[model samples]
Target: MAQAGEQAVGIDFGTSTSLLAVGSGVGPVDIAPLGRTTRSFPSIAGYQQGNLLVGEAAENLPIAQVIRSVKRAITDCSETMEISDEHGTRRVDVDEVIVALLAEIGTRAKAAGRPLDTREQVRLGCPAMWDGAQRQRLLDHAQNAGLPVAHSTLIDEPIAAGVAWVRHRYLQYGEQVEGRLLVFDMGGGTLDIAVLDVVGGPHPEISVLSALGVQLAGDRLDTAIAGEITEELAGQGIRLDGLPEAKTVEALVLREARTAKIQLTTQARHRIVFRGLARTQLPILTYTREQLEECFRPQMDQAIGLVWAALRAAKLTELGGHAPDKLRGMNGDRLAADIDYVLLAGGMSRVPYVERRIGELFPNAMIYDAAGVAADELIVAGLADPVGYDRLNLHRPGFDFVLEYTESGRKITEKIYPAYTPFYSPEEAWTNSYLGFERRGDDFPGPKRGEGVLRVRSTSGDYLALRYDGETKHGLRLQLGWNMLFKIYCDGQILITDGARQTRKLRVHQWPVVRGNGHAELVLQRVDDAPPVPSTAWYLEKEYAPPGL
Candidate 1:
């Protein structure tokens, strides 16, 4: 129960897990998962015989009626929300399901000694493509959970992953921003690909150029792999049979198979035994890493293609002007047109094939193995930025920031430079070039022809700097079907684009910002001033634009 006037904490309510951190002590500390000071909490909630079980309790239940993939339901509105209880079945609101899990964890934090009545501001992370509707639902849910959100904001997933990765890299290495940093987060619900240039200083700076994100992540890949495995076994005449439901066996077997696949990262192979599998004799099966890779090789290759596409989107010229800084860090891979450095992070990145494939894909790329920086992801990232819980009290309105967003989905869509995604150092927080827009619910300011789109982003990264990255999955040759989305600055009077034109006015829209899960929508904002800003000293470049903008 945080009291009024208290600074809010940082909560990473991930799809597969829930993590809580306070800006107190030295750096943000992850409240214990099951005990005091724990870092990771299993993302499972269950409704049982007249009781709600969460975390370990729900995880250990026989056959476990716990809800595991609740996040998926949030995005798929047509899907029903139901959970099996010991006595029978129960249907619940999707938001309430999440609230139950949140309350469970919040209670754990309180029990673990986190002082009550001390959180005021809240910073949340969402997918880059999360429509305005999904964001609104999230806000509403947070309120119902009793989490007061003053100075509330949404952080892109890749940017949040960028923050977790950059911080870990700096803490592992030295002080100055290290070489070109690219954080590839293939999480449960979405895949966020970001590249950044970390600047040098006592604190550090991160400049992000682009982040190509989509709803394809580890779980989705797991499902595909499981299907392939089933197909392979079926081809051998080992059919799942005699089960209560044939589909259930495949689904449960697939889930277990994926767990084993992840385990194979360290173990040569993993085997599971499902007493009720279709094939009685082969009810227990074993799988090797090579086997798993073989089943999902095509998808992995597609992932690599996306990575290369991201590099091409960056459009970094080898010219003397701005060679990719061999050592820099930030959100979105804006430092290089071609990835010479691949920084793999997140829980799923443990797959050896991920590292192996990255090396194979980019013959010239350097991959930094941060010892699978997943368990201590955020804590180890606590280094670079010295300001932890102490700065929570200030509540500074102006945090020096450069914003980037897709005006239209195209080659440039992947490279919108944001200030919050990558880990960075301390920097000033005023701006003359900075134009502002309010993202309340679905309301947003739209762009007009000749008026470039300007994305207003909150300053949330540990470091400060700007870099852009991009990728053309559909290819620019198919430009006829592409709607150009430029990431630029709005100095008020004229919109900005780093392209052939820098001055333009975006048309304001009265519609609404996006609120759906897989859709992206933006409403045009009204501009009162002809020329915007009182002028926060511009320390970085005057303008930032995505590749081929």
Candidate 2:
């Protein structure tokens, strides 16, 4: 159990930077690496023969030995990476390196006064395409590190992102929401879109329409710009791609270049010093925005094309020709083509051109009204909030996710969490409701008693009421924090089971009462001798109430 004020944080491990946030009301409140401008440690890790170095300290090692882009290796299983420092080179498994990074993050979490890993509450975001094996390996690695990892879930980056966008715009610090919406998550590695039908008649129907995992992102555009610089430098009779030494110098020069590339989109032109390995003073490289856009224009178009694909899927979701129609969420009616709104997320979303391109392609939709951020950060924030999904559902057109598998070494398609049921509840925090993936009905396994996944994201001193799909069962509450005598209850069974922050002298309703109706009553249960909050909640469709409620 976690402290009452604690948050089940969401971690976004990106190629360039990684971040963590707790609950929605307060914030991700950046956890800085020691002695920096409150910036996160670079994902880069450096190994000096025997010792290990992570973040800025690791930069001391030669660039080659300092593994900077660990995100690239998450998908591949049979990959072996080697880094060398003058004296010798060593080999490390990619997953091991990833774990090392996570261990450092755990350290960061402890420093922040919120140790999610130690507390066993955290939702991890992964590329949408990460498979069972990939997810399993990453989860194993996380568990190995003292990540508290009590309940670690693999959320697709895009979906996590979509969830975030929803929070940014709709969820008020102290409130409950109801509705349908859309989430667009474009990040350093991929672009994802979801149309959520949040759960409940008004608040829980968070069904995902589709999650499109794009292979291209900021890195691709950066590479295109780098390629152009190389070509231009080569034409200047400066061979940046010729000799190995020359390539090294060129790589280093471009090191400070992409930041400039991103800057160029907003700034007219950025200055650059291209060095020459052959002629000590001759290979200096310089650049301008015109040259960048000329080279990266194709990649930019590709990104726009991908966004179009997402919009098309969203259209299908609204129309219900898709599997979601079977869910019959949208009043048994199809939505209009012109969507209500479109929200943006991820670091790349900050790129001036990205919004422009998105606007051009998806003129029918308006960008989320929330403050903009790196494409990935939005999702990180959303994940921190319990009501993140609810906000989007209430504010936007709607979102959805399409599940897929591969056969004969090829990708297969399936619509598991259709857009019609976006906010559907899960069994345990460890379970995913894509029944086929992690759960099943009574037909296959044990009698399918209600396995409810009631997740509520929030910040400190904040209270929430969640009604799941069952009758009032016994009440259950697990509090790692204060022990309040009276908490909130719903249907007179489950108790809110946490903080007395809002318990008023006048407002008796403010007491932690489990609020709402569902198939299973959401109750905080005292399975054992635990008090304050029970270990869990059970909503009973039949007859279920607390011992004395």
Candidate 3:
């Protein structure tokens, strides 16, 4: 049994399936099984007679009473969804549904001989495209679910998957796996692809080169197969009867279709006999592997195209562009020799046809099937960063903090925080933290206002140079309907710029500094004698505005 202290746990809060695992401190990092299968738990939840059901129990419940793919609703900014029961249909908060599912993961963890709620630290994975609000909602749900989280972090799902792949390569081959890797994740609700560069060593580093996602995935294929089955049953004079509404019948067919889809992974054909469905015995729908493959052919092709697009977006492979020193060895559409492996993750990646297609596409590289490692367990295993397994880097920030102002009839703008400032570098032991922006005017000065304070530190570089990033937009935008202030702190000195000075410089001799917002450059003059440094830490002190006294 593991000790009763800080137990590191990682949870992959996926759209179709969710999983939890414990790291080395609690013996080997292993996934906590959900009921019978050591694979994954359905990301489903139901509320019946005031009793919440999650995972397998939720799956066993009637389709009308349970909610599946709640992750999609959450991403759409939906507050609640309607579910029917004996009392009638009622609306339930989306957060509550997510909380119930997460709570189930905690319960199952405890039943597996380990308790997740008592863990020292927990890291949850989320989609890459999720914004601040979406990410916060996930954290709020986790907390409400009563997961004992002394410390918590939300990492990008693809990045976490990359961490797991690197670790697996090291353990299996006893060799450091370096070079670029492409992760094709086709889950129930979303298909996302990410290109990562894994630097092998005692401390492996994973950096995201590019990532792309589409709404079409396993669920979409399931719906397509269901439609085909429906057509086939109609041809046999077997129509769904005695169902309350068409939606219920459609849902029932989809459920059975998903089961058939899973079976097609190994079997050449599947017989989806709809007996007692809709209170009638629908004809047995026979779907051959070829038929199912034909149904999803277009979607499969799109998924393959997405992989190439992601690769091009990462600049690893390109077409019609003059060859540069960076991407030297390249034939059109062919990946670079440096790309060591192509890893297929997520539940849909297990499809035999999909695996075969990916292998044929990347003939030079070894293709890894996620089934061996368990798709849902990959990200959770990445939470073991403290034990030398982690994504050691971050992609460039999408936006740049710029100060723009009108100077002598001409507008001048200066970038304060340039894109890619080494947010969460490999040497750093902790993740990067973003400055908080509140709704109050006093807390963050209006856009017209200039000069604010900021604190910053770096794991590398002597002088933190502020440069222009042509890639990001250059403008100021309010956060949550409130204006923001720029802060740049170097050592104990604060430099406030509001685009007034074309050239600005801050010297701190490599010491950690602060951040601020302004349009003018500040050059502090050395004095023969100055007041002793304030006893209180500058960061702890709040900016004060004196009353008109």
Candidate lDDT values, in order: 0.47, 0.49, 0.59
- What does candidate 3's lDDT look like per residue over 1-549, in tens digits? 123233567888788788777665323467777655745778888876788778777766767677888987766789988887667778888887898888888788778876765434577877665554566677778888887542125666776677777766665565688788888877877777888878864457666666667777888999899888887877777565534554566677988889888999889988886543454445566788898789989998988777665664466212112223323334424653545688877888768888887777777788876522666456667654334333244443322444444445665544455432322221221221221111133443334444322312121111223322322222223222133334332121222323232112222122111122321122232211233333333342243210000
Pairwise lDDT winner, candidates 1 and 3: 3
User: Candidate 1, overall lDDT?
Assistant: 0.47
Give the best candidate by TM-score: 3
> Per-candidate RMSD vs. true structure?
13.0, 14.8, 12.4
Judging by lDDT, tell me the better candidate of 1 and 2. Answer: 2
lDDT, residue 336, candidate 1: 40
Residue 418 lDDT, candidate 2, scale 0-100: 25
In angstroms, give how far residue 430 of model 3 lies from its true place: 36
Ranking by TM-score: 3, 2, 1
Question: Model 1 compared with the native: what TM-score?
Answer: 0.62
Instruction: Write the residue-wise lDDT of candidate 2 on 1-549 in tens digits.
Output: 122344557777777677877763434424323224444556778777567778777866665577766766765454657766665656766776788888888787677666664343477777655554565666777878766442124466666665555444443342223344456566666655565544332132345544555557666776777667667667887675565565355555556466667677577777666433444444555567677667666767776555444443444333212232222233211343345556667777776666676666544555662433455466666556554433222211112122223345665333222221222221221142111111112212211222212232211112233333233422122221243222112111222322322211111111121112221222233322223333233431112223232
Q: TM-score, each model?
A: 0.62, 0.63, 0.70
Backbone clashes counted, model 3: 28
